[model samples]
Target chain A: MDTQPFYVAALDGLFGSFPTDADSLWVMLIGSLVGASCALVGSFLILRRLSMLGDAISHAVLPGIVIAFLLTGSRNIFPMLIGAGALGLLTAFLTDSLHRYGKLQSDASIGVTFTWLFAVGVILISRFAGQVDLDTDCVLYGEIIFAPLDVLIIGDNEYGPRAVWMLGGVTLANLLFVVFGYKQLKVCAFDPELAASLGIKVSLWHYLLMGAVSMTTVGAFESVGAILVVAMLVVPPNIAYLLTDRLGLMIALAVFFGILSAVLGYWVAYWLDASVAGAMATVSGLLFVLVALFSPTHGVIARVVAQRRLGSSTIEFADSAPS
Target chain B: MNESSDLPPWLEFFTFSNVNVTFVFLGCVLLGMSTGVLGCFAFLRKRSLLGDALAHAALPGVCAAFLLTGTKNPLIILGGAMVSCWMGALSVELIVRYTRCKEDSALGMVLSVFFGVGIVLLTYIQRTGEAAQAGLDKFLFGQAAALVDRDVWTLGILSVLILVVVAIAYKEFKLFSFDPEFAAGIGLPVRLIEIILATLIVVAVGIGLQAVGVVLMAAMLVTPAAGARYWTERLGVMLVAAGSFGALSGGLGAYISYLSPKMPTGPWMVVAATILFVISFTFAPRRGVLPRVLRHFRFRRRTAEENVLRTLYLLGEPLGQWNDSFSTNELLQYRSMPTAQLAHTLNRLIHKALVKEPAQGRYALTDFGVTRAARVTRLHRLWELYLTRKLEIAPDHVHDDAEEIEHILTPELELRLEALLEHPDEDPHASRIPGRFVPGESGG
Candidate 1:
């Protein structure tokens, strides 16, 4: 009852007994960076209407990481990331191909591809669960608490967690892609066939966009796990879309919403003594719902209000018209 | 032979030996039957894959129910899944009706957003450290091996209830699904019928959720329908075929995983269903690829014969004088046509008796051919006038349409077309119209 207040929960996490300063700051920074990365990439992803692919790739990355560990016999970040990203790319391509060539609908093709792929990963993890340190059950439901333990050092000053660095690198790469190909991506997203007719090479752009999503998603997967990664990709961009019409403004709003969710989620989780990823996803979901229902121009409330106004205007016009 | 034959009797056997296997088999068969019936309507309505979105939407529902009731009782969890899935279906329909977004986007957005919420709730449960929460996460990916007897009872009873509803409302559901515009015109409750169909699918998916998980539940509803589509166009046949396919796949997937202990049942079930789809995709009776290809080839051959007659009629003497016989070299050289193409055309002409070889390199049309050739040419000229005169097409548009229409134009349709055009003697280009086939006129 005493911890019901928001400010009290924030203060507790800031100087909590359980997680020391290093741990608290690192988890928050890594979580926010991962949050921002998913938002930035997800901005274009949602625009391209590829959020489902984002979900599939993120979840499907588990077996890739597991397989990478088995081959390299090392638990380092670089190899595992490359392996996972490759798997993500494969899932994206396979899903797109199945829809395009195999004539399966988007959800069915994606559902068939990912569940089968993830099932493979889970089975492998369960099989070698003893030998393999990381398991898919942990992967599907992420464990952000252990993230702070995997720290990266930069000389005597020391640096943030490895997850923060990975997510930061991905965020930087995603930002560059967005900036460099903004116009092309926009044109392609709007009318793909027109983009093709205009010689924009839509297939090339699609693969490029999907590659960026897979890369950033795999990087974030190491931190929040697959399920939370999906929430990050979907919720923030959707909130940003609710806030603005312009792509630039939308990305900014998404990053803002995402970072805001990370901070609030960490505090809420600390007070409630629950999972950080769950809090972040729930907060993000709450933000999305609020925006969906209340954004001035596009929200559900705005729609209903506009309908009423139109109804009144029609009657007035009808009364004034000459019979 | 068949891959199933290669396996040992123990592995290839259909059902489980003990009560565990029997219950699961019976439950899956009933589940398959229910979904197949509902899926027929869904597919007919062209929203074949909405079931996938609803299946994932059930996740947050189950989790929310757990949070409120503090129980993992099958009924409670099923209730939770049903509520959310129902909401998801509503949201999908609302988005499509309200927004300018295309159907795919509407489906994609609803699926992603609902699934995102489900993931959040699922992860929240795992992090809560509840003692009974061990198998709760399994709902996300489904684990058929864990399905006990009571679960089977719940699934079987629900399936029977749905089957009964489908049977009682068969006529209404069919008419509504196939042509709602007409059904509405006839005063049928199209909206209520659609709702019932959707509710049926939700119930079936909710039951399957325990065994297949969110990911595979969509396939359970769609793959069987897709596979069945190849075998028949009739609704009754399709429903039965899909149900059988679903049942067989579900049993095989469960039996495979049970025997191996390493593989999961859901994916294997999808594999079996996909295999059936592939079979149907290749070899279905009327619409199969092979039949389509053969039909296309035959049409092309027939079209070529008609074109040969039209060309002979245009180039030959007006009174059908030496039209049949033409030099092979001259034929190939006339339009820069390939020599092989000229040969193929000549061979077909000889086969059809329109043209013949009197001697080496000498060709002539029979009396039968010349009259037929003139009739075709007249049809072409008449169509040309009809296009330019009756249709008010430009002189340019008339020729392009007439060029193609002349060959396929049957005598009966041509007479009707000419009558409709009010009988013109000359085309827009001032070319003389050929005489019509009257009593005892040429080939008439």
Candidate 2:
């Protein structure tokens, strides 16, 4: 019966300047960066109808990261990146070959490959729980609140949370790839055959794009876990695709939505005292629903309204034409 | 560790002596059978991931059911899961139908978002520190060993119910999967049938959730059906094969989990199913990859031998003697095939008694070989003449098309082509067409 208003409490928690609040801020920052980078590559994936491939890659990278950690007894980013990238490309290639040669449908092939890899990763983790640093719970939901504790200190100069720096580098790399290869990616995604006829190596660009996705997935893995990474990779670009036509505008909108979801999700989690990754995914889902309903150009409500107006205008034109 | 140390030995795990292991194994077998059968429809409909979305969507339902009832009854929780998953499936259908979003994107959105809500609720319940909510997290990655006798009974009854429904409506489901429009045209309630099928899938997912969990339940639904597809083309046979494969995987998975107390049943079960899928993909008789590859290799070898025979026949033709032997060097001027490959083909032909070597370097067709060669040449010329005369293709273009067709033409097709060509004696290239030889008669 005695409770503060939800919005006031949420706002206070988001902007409050307590020492513990720094952790929430870092969590939000890392989430935003990861979300942005995921969206950057995810736009191309959605455009190419490879949205499920993003889901597949996110799940398939689990074994790669676990194996990488086992080989090197630390959670170093480089080995994880290399391992996950290799597996991600392998996921794409295997899905393609199974569909082409094994005569399996694309969806079935994806479902088969990712689940098998994920099962292997989970079995390995459970079997060697004492030796592995990561646990199944961490791999499933992630412990982003603890991420800030793992600070990157160089010669007593603290460079903030290691996740923040790792995600920052990933975002920069994704931005560079997109900026330099925008034209080729656009052509290849829209019309692969035309791009090939125009002398562009469609498959090379495809693998390059998947490599970017792999690296981004690995970077985001430690913070959000695999399923939430899938949400981040798919939800934002999908929302953006519903609202825009041009690729450049779509990418920009996707990044904007990603950041918005992260900030809003952080506040929601702080108020509810729940998992931040879950809150973020929830917010992204909510954002998508909102855009699907209200976007001025392609939204359900807008189209319905436009149709009503068109009906009246046509009636008026008919009345005038008869006279 | 202390608890597992007191448990039975590894070999005894399979003996059905332990009440708990027996119940768990039976429950998993039933779960696998129902999901496998229902998944065949999903796979054929090209919506194989629907089960996955439905599984993830059931998470919040389980949590909500627990929060509301404050109990951990499997049936109650499963009921809640079915409702929630059905809502997710319906929303996906609505989204794809009304909006520009495709099914894959819609599936991804529903799966992650609903799971997110479920995670929030689950964490909320865990924080509340209710003793009743202790085993709720097991639904994420299932703990099959925790299944009691009552839970197993509940799962078995539900699975059998699903199987009965599918059995009674087999023809309807078959018609719906192969061609829904025709079913609808015939006044069948196509939409209702689809909903029934979708509900069956969700029910299967709901029951399996406690054993396989949400993350890997899709594997149970997809892998068995996919593996079964390689062994048969009949719907009935595929469904049965898939069910057996699923049951086998489930039993093996439960056994493995029993062997090591720390291991989860869901992943091991998935691993077992994947092994079966790999076996089917590699070794099944008709549609398996190995057989298809072998068939391709055999066809390639046959084509090579036929090409060599045609070449020798043509070379002997220019000398005005069909039975004359020709040297390998002399044959090389007309055909550009690799020498080693040509020699291998020659050896195979000799082994078949189609060709014989009179000297070390010279080869000639035997009486049987001449008759076979004339028949092959007749079919090739007939095709070339058909293309030039009926299709109006130029002579040069007809040769390339006829070259590939010459190896695969069946006898019935050759007869049809001969009848269509009115038994032409010459091709468009002004070369004489070989005719069939009677056994006692010389070359006509």
Candidate 3:
């Protein structure tokens, strides 16, 4: 009975008493913040069709983090952000260069560039195993459970987990960036040439958006890990996309779903006694599946029903109606 | 082997008789080769990142297999990996085909989500305290040093199977890669072939997981093929080159890890493959950056020289003095080329024995230069005439188009243009179109 399967355990926890402990609250807060920040920036990434770029930046930031650790001899947030931000931009630049100048296909260029950078990062971690506190597994799947333990003690006054403060700051920054740059980002995403003709620097907005994504990814990385950060970046936004036609609504919905998954995922992890970040990502995936199949406007089921309704309509009306 | 142990560490590492090293080396090479071969299909289909998605998606499958069988059997685990990888691939296809999600988004979503799920399953397994579940986490980042004889044999057999399937279905795959619609029109079973190739890729990714791990397996599949593309135009040549590159990187990566006990094998393999990609991208004969840049430079220089010679001919046109001298300033007035460039072009022409500095700061066309200049003028005029008379573009609009084409027109194109226009004698602006350069003839 103690060795209950994961699904059964998860079901039990869903109906069972919810953990209201401070630690669990802290974990859920950090998770939701990470989710919100990632979703805010990821909406723009999906709009730009640069979702893979988000993935690439997430992986490629590893070496930057490692190098920053080596140079600073500490895991201070600012240096890590700067290092990872620079490397994130470099990954974007290199992938673009390889695609445009080197004439490699976009996917291959992306695949080659990030994996190479990630490999270098792994080697650095292994070579400096003694000095570096990071490992490949930790980079892939983070230690969210220990977030509360790494308390930010400022001169004997104990604050909560550092991740909460870091993620909150990032989420706020991402919110501001997205809110302020809405018009510019929308134009640039929908039509770069038109945006350029309108005197908006498309590349500037591009890098700015990429910069925001990098910061969000780095902030979320401690709680969700790099791979799950990608999930947070892509899945919720896509789910929102399926539900809405307006960009503003889409972004809002994405953030809503993101936080929903985060809280639900914490409970799931609690029930299954597994990784919190992974459960969050899985819950998001399941959410996306649900929305994809059942959204009113764009869901698969709606489309099929619409098709059947059209098929049964009068021929003259059906012929007159534009597809 | 015992005697070799007393040798220096570096020397001792290279001795092939060491059984463990042999197994590791063979496993990686075979893994590299198979992935490289399967990657071509994916790359051609523009699905390079699909390999990454499949690799990441395999993790939960691996954990699920261990949980189901409660054994550490490699075959069973890999079997589970294939099933889930196939499922991931199917999900990607479904999302792209039926939904509004773009392929890239679908790939990213599936990749990260499946990997997350896998992480959940793996962590669950760890908490369960399954005795046989030791070292399952190695799939996260492969530990190639743990390769034994049985693993080597499995990798070897799988590599051969991938190679054989690719070879036997070579024609179908080539058709499928280049033009699926045409292949289907010709009665080929396009769907079945796609499934087969997808299966092959799934297996290739499956085999590579233990050697290269989930994150890097995409590099093994993509880098070799991408590097090989820069080196060859033919599909057959690309496959061979990619396979060789894959094998070379695998062996090199294995050796590097052998030398440094602390360094992991998978990353080094990726690094080695990337080094090869960089080399190929830079230095391959035709498609490489170096040659492409060289070609562009050469073309620019030729355009400049030809423009100068054509200007000299136009300047001398009214007087009919093909041998008349012209200063740099005079040439720039007619051509708008930079003054310094005109002088440099004159010097190059002098070296070619086509133009001579009859006086300081002044140039004259040699007999050869007049003939070459006439050829350029003629092609320029013929294109203008063709455009105005046949395509109905304004004569003014034709000159700008002809300016670009005059430098690029091959001799065959020049002849074709002349024949099409019936060797017209004058351009739209009333400038006489010069004849083809005949070495012994008088200058036009």
Candidate 4:
């Protein structure tokens, strides 16, 4: 695999040329930052059985991004983040409200809410096609290859990539939120009933988690697009979940896997000269497949081997004892 | 095309003289109709996200087929899409069955993973620089303007096949959707039926990829059926409504994009479907948000009116005066109601001929009003007595419980309470339980 020209060229292009090539370095850094931020909140979402809600939020935040662009009349990250974050929470609220009050099923409401919002976003993009230089294709799959070009500038000083700063701030905020609210989030995720019995406001923690997810999603959306954000949010954390039983360990493992995917995914995309976000998503999925099939305690192979051992030992015991 | 641009967009769209417009419009409508019918089954079975997963999953198949066959043939490409989409569904089932991952996690995983793989393949194709790859990217968001005679024919045949299959296996599909366990218990082949249904969904999703694209196709599948659900409870009616709503959105989407150059047809179709969903969710009769809210307000109003009438009867009970006029202030003292509310209730009661505002602000019960108010007070006091005696509730704690039950108790329950309490003469408060006859019968 290492001898292949595609592989060697990709490795050299991203790593051997690393010090000189700020483009590959920034794309990799930004991807890892986004991946790690998403994985932090995604762990709780998986524990709470709300993985699809993450997918829904990622799509539903589009209109908020579009509307922010429309209002601010520029691709300002702060306004887009605020706008999309608010809409993300609204998506969660509306989905829950429709389920609780409208008597619509939860899955159907999620489907309805996100798709509607995404449609509105797409329509807005087309309506203002001339006014805004927003590309629909970029929004769908993303072009992480161009992430370095959107550099942050501050008063005669070029501070790195804008996506890096945006994603880094979100990652820090997520870290603080998870650290401070760990106990409540754990209780709420594992058992809302018990959390309520203990006098914890389950809904407050639920919304807090939702807000964190929305904020993370908006920050990540620029580089990875919407759907691939789901891949980052769900796949890495899920792989970690299969590997560990403890909550703290799971969160740690998920972040590790997320960053690992970002690093490896960059190479894969460089090799294929394709979508870096898509490559990252594909790599994370492959990692999950590997873990699901080979995890020591819960893997399919372990279970199969255990069952086979039990079967053979029982047969031997029967033959020796007699009959 | 230049000459038609002079006419109103709506008029031109409806004219159907432009062959291209007619093909795209008809193609989208058929796609919508098929997806709508399939969406009902998916929605009922709680597999709405499966459609999303399948739609995203079909991407790799489309690209894979284009690479393998090196042709732009619609049938072959769609065939590849159907196969891979089916595999995606199978993988989700396998993951859930084999692993500890919940259904939603499995769905989210499969949906994004397959889409990622598809993106990789799509890029791989684009980088190869083949001339055929020019329009292949259209499958991502869909390009309805690309529909030709052949594409329309393919969509028509697929739509008809979907309609026929659903119609022929209506009972089986219905039973499988509402209660698959029972369908199996009754000796129906539930697994086979499930496969057939999955196949139907794959076909519906496959046909829609070229029109709504993969990302927005879930809306075409979900919004129409969800909207239709608000309009009816019966399965048959829901299917028809969903199909019509779907077709309407599809046609509207095509027309809007036609009117405005560069407007993508797929998202517009979704926007149109979402509008229908919002309308149905908020305004549909009986099950709609407005109707339910209206019913609640009306109930509250009725309860307020009855409470006022009960107060009027109770005020006159000790005085032994059924026709005596009382000021709004007096009624408020007895009932603890607002002065304005009392006046409003009095007006409504007068309108019903139950009360007469004989003076500027004073009111009195008519003969009919006395009878009506007596029934309300009797139910209230009767409930109090029953709660105290039968339920062993404290005599002092029965008023609040009785207040709520009085407004809700039916006539048959009133008689049952009468028999249960042996027709008590006095409530726990020692107030007279007004008799049903004239005031002289038992109050004093």
Top candidate, metric TM-score: 3
Candidate closer to the true structure by lDDT (higher is better), 2 or 4: 4
| Per-candidate TM-score against the hidden true structure | 0.79, 0.91, 0.92, 0.88
Chain B TM, every candidate: 0.81, 0.93, 0.93, 0.90
Task: Report candidate 4's fraction of native contacts.
Answer: 0.73
Clashing pairs in 2: none
RMSD to the hidden true structure, all candidates: 5.8, 4.2, 4.3, 4.5
lDDT for each candidate structure? 0.73, 0.84, 0.87, 0.85
Give each prediction's DockQ, rounded to 2 decimals: 0.26, 0.55, 0.66, 0.56
Which wins on TM-score, candidate 3 or candidate 4? 3
Give the Cα error of residue B383 in candidate 4, in Å: 3.2
lDDT (10s digit) by residue, model 4, range B1-444:
748367777787788888888999999998888888889999997778888889888988989999999998878888999999999888887788777777778889999889888888898998889878887767656778887898889888989899999999999999989988899999999878978888888888888888777768888888899999999989999999999999999998899889886898988888899899889999999999989999999888888889888777777776778777888888888888777777777788899999887888778899999888888888889988888888889998999988898889899998888888887788988888877566565452
Residue A99 C-alpha lDDT in model 4: 82
- lDDT of each residue in A1-323, candidate 1, tens digit only: 47468876876567463454777777777778878888887887777766667667866787798999888887877888888889988898877876675555565566556655665676677577677888556556556768877778878765767777777888899888988998888889878988888889898998998898888777777777665677778778877876788988988898898898887777667766666776777677667667777888778789889999999999999999999
Give the range of the ten consecutive residues with the poorest summed lDDT in model 1 chain A: A11-20
Docking class of 1: acceptable
lDDT of 4 at A21: 64
Candidate 4 CAPRI-style tier? medium
lDDT score of residue A318 within candidate 4: 89
Top DockQ hit: 3
Model 4 Cα shift for residue B109 (angstroms):
1.1
Candidate 2: Cα lDDT at B97: 74
Error of 3 at B181 (Å): 3.3
